[model samples]
Target: MPWEKQFDIDEVLEKAMTAFWHRGYTATSMQDLVECTGVNRASLYATYGGKRDLFIAALKAYDESGRQALFAKLEALDDPKEAIHRLFWPMRPWHPGLVSCVAVS
Candidate 1:
C-alpha cells in the first residue's frame, strides 16, 4: 500500500524557493521547508531528497524561468534590435529578490 499523499510540486517549489530566497541556504532548515512547502519531513526527503537537493531544484527552476523568458525575447522576430534592447535594457530590470538569488549561486 502506498502511504504517500498527493501534493502540488509547483506550489511546493514556489514556497521552498521563497523560503530559501528569504533565509538563504545556510539558514533555511528542513523544518522551515516543511512549514514553508507544506510537505512533511519524511515526504520531503522521499520526494526531493535533502535540503541541498531541494535547494538545487529551486535554483534550477528559477534558472529555467529566466532562460525561457530570454528565449521568448530572442524569438520575437518582428524587431530583433528592439527585442534585444528590451532584453538588455528593460524599463525595470531585474527583480530584487531574483537578483539576490542569482548572487547566491
Candidate 2:
C-alpha cells in the first residue's frame, strides 16, 4: 500500500527548510529531515523524490516567502534606504529562532 501523508506540506517544508537552513545541504541528512519535519523517509522520498529534490523545494519555498515579505515591506516605504532597511532589518545572524547554515566569522 502507498503511504498516505497525514500532515501539511507547508508545515513540512517549513521544518525541512529550517533544517536545511540550520544545516547546510551537505551536512543535512535524510534522517535529520525526517526527524525535523515529522515526515518519514519513505514519505519524503515518495513526495519529493529525495533529499536533494526536497532541498530544492525547500529553497524555492524559502525564496518565494522571503521575496514576498521583502516586496510587501518595500511597497510600504517610499524611500529606498528605508525600504532596504525594512527589507533587511529582521534578518540577523543567530536570531532567536534561526539557525545558520554555515558558521559566520
- Highest TM-score model number: 1
User: Clashes in model 1: which pairs?
Assistant: none
Q: In order, how many clashes per candidate?
A: 0, 0
lDDT of 2 by residue, 1-105 (tens): 866679899899899999988888899999999999887798899899999999999888889999898798799888988886665557764476554423431
| Model 1 ranges with Cα > 4 A deviation | 1-5, 73-77, 90-105
Residue 16 alpha-carbon offset, candidate 1, angstroms: 0.5
| Model 1 score (lDDT) | 0.83
Candidate 1: tens digits of C-alpha lDDT, residues 18-66: 9999999999999999998878999999888999999998888888988
